[model samples]
Target chain A: MGGHELSVQPDAKLGLHKNWFNKLTSAWASGLGAVTHKELADHLGGKRLLILLGLVAVTGLSAVYVAASTIRESAMEAVETGFVFLLLFSTSGGSLPSFLSFLGFLGPLLGLALGFDSVNGEQTRGTLSRILSQPIHRDSVINGKFLAALCAVSLALVALTLLISGLGIELIGIPPSSEEILRVVCFALLTIVYVAFWLSVSIMFSIVFRQAATSALAGMATWLFFTVFATLLAGLVADAVVPLPSEPTALELMRHQRIEMALSRLSPTTLYYEATSTLLSPHTRALGPISVEQLEGAIPGPLPLSQSLLLIWPDVAGLVAATLLCFAASYVLFMRQEIRAI
Target chain B: MNQGNVVIRTRDLVKRYGSFVAVDRLNLEIYEGETFGLLGPNGAGKTTTILMLLGLTEPSEGSVQVVGLDPTRDPLGVKKVVGYLPDRVGFYEDLTGKENLLYTAALNGIPRKQAEERVNELLERVGLAEVADRKAGGYSRGMLQRLGLADALVKKPRIVILDEPTLGIDPEGVRQMLQFITQLSKEERVTVLLASHLLHQVQQVCDRVGIFVRGKIVALGCVEELSSQLFKDEPYVLEVRAQPTTEELIRNLKGITGVDAVEQAGDTLLLHCMSDARGEVAKVIYQSGTSLLHLAVRGRSLDEIYRRYFLTAEEQTHRRAG
Candidate 1:
């Protein structure tokens, strides 16, 4: 007994020498690493990710295939424009909207699926209490799970985009310009941010609702409101707020369009669409209503890549801010929650 | 028992959920290397108190210190040396038992090589070595519990808190688990705080038991001390079995001065006495020409102690109400 006590004494004393900050940082780092590694492995190996990836891939490939053939039909014209690669993502072929539009519509589902059960599922499985009982900070669980899921989403998005680009190159026989490649990269990043915002929202719902099914339903409901109804709601709101006459003045017309744009931007889907459109089509110089006088001296040709990025900076910032806001909300709620065995 | 170092102490610790008091002004001290039982029934606030001690839930008042560190102020420091097995211990169903333990090992910051060795050792100790490679989803209830035990010990903690370790296991499994816990505390010299509503099961393992009722500890001490203190009026119970027993034998046994009551239960004579009267009762049976087959004194079981205490408390409340 005495020998056992002596052996354990050193470990107790070792914890006392370190300052609180150092102890906290080390615990947080170790915990974050463990949780992220485990969750990432689970995500990559699980059937859930495979199903979601399959859904997104099939739709994205079909859209890109149609766009590639359409771009091929006008191959000579597209080649002269130096942005045939960008057209692969933006051009609407037949009944299918562009590949970018397909992503804009489907990305939120991927985010929601990944995060809707993150916190609540742990509670249901009775692991939350066990995990929180560890020496790690409580916030590490949420942060690590979020980081892992984001990495999975990013990996999937990047791979899917690369695959489409490769196929487009084969179909059109036009290797992308450096600027076009840069634009595509920026477009992918913007999509990731938009998806991250939805991910955070779903994670927040997971923390708020105790049942995983309930949280998933809440997440899908929010997704439906934003993706399918937000645009129509914005149109109604704009019509009600700024009703246009048959021969409306230019200011009135601009006001109606501006109101509709602002209201629709409230949805992350709209922000993603606007940003991706600007990134993929450099000719998009203005997002909101612009006067004829403001465009009087502007050239009709495609703007530089820098100008396109500058035009879409606010949209990207909005997406990032929304993501951060949702993440902050979930963090606060999760940290404050009482971790009792349910 | 009090000579050992104080490993876990709480002063005026209270927890409340709005108007409901979960743990009320709890003051406790547990010594190092002792198996302490927090015995209580459902809704007695055992789980709440355990949570506060682990710093998973904040107390509404007062403080708790585990291994010389405040759990709320430095939970990492406290948790570093303390392992916990929650009430309904869960594991990732998809992951194998070894994988689950490894995850816990990683969470405790154990290196891969060291963690692997430690995990294997624990699995072997918990007797889950044979099924360590199987997915936990298919593990039996007893197996999952053993896995949970391995998970808790992954950190090699100095202190271990097990909340209802044998809540829903077969009788054989419960006995084995309790025996394992007793052997663990003895071998490792680890301070153990076991919370359970099953008094008899707790009696088998714990060195000291605290009877928690309605968010307060009604009694605390070793079983012998508590029994002696509560049953001072009749400190001993002796059971005598004899052949060719007659009415005169019972009458003579009752004549012993310290014997309180004598009742014939089947073939045995149960005597509630103020002293150990096994010798006197045996002599009386022999004197009456009744062959004394067996004579033994029965220790007070926790069930009787708990029932007697609860009855007295209820009577006191009833008297006050009246």
Candidate 2:
């Protein structure tokens, strides 16, 4: 008895939209699904551990936050301030392993962190070579890992967001408007993109480093630099790059411009916060008046929301572009690196 | 077992790492339904060759074709048909053995229902049926090897490449491993390429063995044939008790018809003579009245054969040095 044969075209290496395509796609889905389930199961601890743990964590966090907020003003402030705190923590933990919340940079750190060691982990585990032994494309492993990582990140972040939101509605006395709901969804997705950036970085690291811990740490380092240290350095660079006069009047204006520009380039969080302010708060503007109208009630000038969005487009594009470039670099390296390495 | 001739053929295949030639220029062929043993020492390029065959690495020079397809150029196609097991099989230690098998089955596009059934059968076959639900991290080395065997066979691949499969296995595990491999070949009749440093194990299981030395294959043939060529020529041995009369009689009889040489081996006197002159050699010993203890034919175990070849290579180096 000779072995089984899958009907494959000699030339079409990638998937096609044929019956074979369906089989291959389903195969990929099942494989990735199993991987996702496995990770989720490991995380929660059993058959439906993901849901079980997710709900438990959700109920616990929500109940605790609601209970705590009622007792302390600081706890109430932590709801929105928690994002900033998380941002700060992630920036700190982004480059190294941590016990709690992963240095607040879990979002962007995840993109690379989730996958940097993806292929190598599988390779060392012997599954990568074994999986390749099947009739699937080497490309499928890459895609499947990326997708599985994506799924893992999505599930985790959504659980976090929903748990928080469920608490916000029940005890915080604010049902998010439909528009706010949309924004929350976008925020969730943005968190995924942030994580994906790290996931890609992690995947590349995985290709470069055979050890999973090394890849994860490297990705965390990248996240740390990008979110925290990069901002600090960019601030210094922005000041150095732009010249200011010593004269008092010109120095003041130059200082103001320098600080604004530096702040703009320093962190994606600052940029995201700026953008979110414009989107969430109707009165905020990109430029113009910083002072109130006089007692005479003379008209005061201020920039519009559209101008604010426009003013921040470059920063938005820069972060998104860097994220994309990192992912692309990882993809190329993984595609090229020989699967056999000691 | 050769159903359709050679399924894989390689000529002058060489792989180098920096200045070291991990795999020297070599030629080889693997036929269908035959378990070909690529036997070698550590760092002898057995794994490198297997990696190239599976398209995990690109060859520096030479050509390799598997199932009439270039492995590098047609890796995806070849991968779809072949199954591989590396030395360190790191599965999702967190995932159950059954889940690991199921994931592999899914990767091969095996239907869910069919896949589960196969997983159950494989789990039972590998003696992990009782603990199929346990996480792989907790598995013993033997259990993992068995699970790996299950993973490889889940797809029922036509070509199976197992690198150091029996390494780190206990005696019972080794028996079971060999038996499972034999079963695959016997039942599924799949072609297997077993690569290892275990020469004796290869000799016991493989029909043909290729002895790889310093990246190149120095010898290739049926095990029996190689053994016959190396050991059959020097088969006769003369033995005598520790006695002055025996020694003198041995020396005196040396010039007799067909005795090649006489030497002392511990308490015994060894006489090398033609196989046809065994009677004459014994008769000469009898006439000396020196009681002969034992006259035994020197038989070569696979270990002895391997040692002889390795020693010959070493001796050539010493000869050159001198």
Alpha-carbon error at B69 in model 1, in Å?
0.6
Regions of candidate 2 where Cα sits further than 4 Å from its true position: A1-113, A172-174, A239-267, A287-315, B1-4, B228-262, B267-269, B276-296, B311-322
Per model, how much of the real contact set is kept?
0.94, 0.66
Model 1 lDDT per residue over A1-342, tens place: 998878765454566765566766775666988999999999999988889889989999889899999988988888777688999999999999888988988899999999999999988888888898888878789999999999999999999999999988887788998999999999888888988998999999999999999999999999999999999999999999999999999989989999999999999889888989988988888998888899998868898999998998898889999999999999999988876534
Candidate 1's TM-score reads 0.92
Score candidate 1 by DockQ.
0.65
Instruction: Report how far off residue A41 is in candidate 1 (Å).
Output: 0.8
Which consecutive 10 residues in model 2 chain A have the weakest lDDT in total? A85-94
Worst 10 residues of 1 chain B by lDDT: B308-317
Error of 2 at B311 (Å): 5.0
